[model samples]
Target chain A: MSAAELHNNEMIHGYLNDLRRYLSRLAPHETQEVIREIESHLFDVLDQQAANGQAADVAEILRGFGDARQLAALYVAHIEEGAPPPRGFRAIQSVKKSVTASLYFAMAVFGFSMAFGLLFIAGAKFLLPESVGVWSTPHGDSIVVGFVSVPPMATPEVMGWWIVPVATLLAVGVAWLTRKVLLVLKQHM
Target chain B: MNSTEALMEKWEVQLRKGTLELAILAALQQRTLYGLELLKLLQSLPSTTITEGTLYPLLDRLKRDELVDAQWVQEGETRPRKYYQLTPLGNKKLTDLTRLWRQSVSDIEWLLANPGPQPLPNTGV
Candidate 1:
């Protein structure tokens, strides 16, 4: 009703808004429950202050709750990490684990095979220079690359010695990317 | 604060953190209090004092752990307050923690009471 009371209400609302934003990670109902409890506590404290003939110092009360972000973080940490998983959550957790595991192995297999394929081509170019070559068709309609026992009849070989360095670079790049991906996946697992 | 006072404050914080759960459980024994009421009761004590920031989240955790139960109660025109009480599990926890606390206090008191003029007494060792 008073100007001061209006300002205090604004401050409380502002604090609660910030708290709600920080607590967005919680389920909607859980977030509302936390907000409601704190709101109730804040108003109760104000009433107590009024009953005692003391002016409502919203700042002092908010200080007891500390920063809204910090308070929300405490709630989030306990709810997310401290509480045990609910029933049927174990199945979901296992499924998640398996998915990560499959992704990791699949990535390793795909990436390493590609890398090894490139490396093999690069190496074979030295041993069988005639067989392993990048070739352009007579009509230049398509290009073929990789190890071939008979180099493709009448297709002029291109990239000569350049294929070795190019393939080697590609192999290194693929291997590095795979390692980075696996590292990220390992953390989730 | 000066270094000595800061050190003392740090020690007090550690002490409070260790005893906080037990203190909460003990406070709720045979009582149902809302957040503000519980906070006031805790602040009334010198050592068990805690802020709203600490209490609410800890209470949430206790409820999640099934150690405490909370209910929203409306009285007349006042806002509905979430009242908390110790569950059976919470009471059992309180009993266990109280025994541990008393034992710790007695052990420390024994050490403090006995000054080293003679060898420390050994019983059944």
Candidate 2:
């Protein structure tokens, strides 16, 4: 064979190899069938050119097939469309989507409510300083937080004016964390 | 390309895409042709010209849809070629599409023949 023919064969094989790689999603036999058909078509075109006394132009022929990846994509697209999803596959996908959506809402509710409660406590501390205080029982067996009808007897209040800043900071941190988490969940949804 | 040329090209692409299946079905009417022959036949026509990338995939789809049947035919000493022919369903589709195509052409022709400043006939309004 001539050097030009050898080079043409190499180029044809190279293009077919790339096409085969891109068609991996197809079944093995189907991939082979696609490859075989294309190879046959290529050779037929070359034979026609030879019969017409024209040189084999592998590049021009490959151009008609366009990019290997794009051609494979077209074949894959139709196969996917032809085969409907398995029974209940769509149901599972929807369930997963809803689960993410519900998780997002649940996280939003839990986080925002916690932040709101903290901010409320901070506000209440200023309005009813005497009613709301954190106290340790006499034996330190238990600690009590939030409003009380009357201040605990003989137990000193902790976080005396600093509770406002502490509660506000905690609220801000929880709110920020909630926002970030919701953003992540939203993407999945 | 100039904007006008670009717009014309886009319109042509849309027109080609819309009619491609009909064209393929019509081409295969009472005829069995392999990929290369079919591609050559289509490229010979002005509007039905398409690439190997487009033709093979579309043929695959037509086969899958039962609109066409393909078989690998091997002649003496030559490579096997997958030849395609219209199935009954494909022929039915071609007939239906031909009717619609004729209807569309006549409608456009009527509109062209009847210019503005004259009310279209057969309109109750």
Clashes of 1: 0
TM-score of 2: 0.66
Clashes in model 1: which pairs? Answer: none
Alpha carbon lDDT at A79, candidate 2:
48
Looking at model 2, give its docking quality level: medium
Alpha-carbon local distance difference test for all models: 0.93, 0.90
What residue runs in model 1 are displaced by over 4 Å at the alpha carbon? A79-189, B123-125
**TM-scores of chain A in all candidate models:** 0.54, 0.53
Question: Fraction of native Cα contacts kept in each candidate?
Answer: 0.96, 0.87
- Candidate 1 has a TM-score of 0.67
Candidate 2, residues B14-110, lDDT tens digits: the string is 9999999999999999999999989999999999999998999899889878999999999999889999999999999999999999999999998
Chain B TM-score, one value per candidate, order as shown: 0.95, 0.95
Q: Tell me the TM-score of candidate 2's A chain.
A: 0.53
Reference-based lDDT, residue A58, model 2 = 95
TM-score of each: 0.67, 0.66
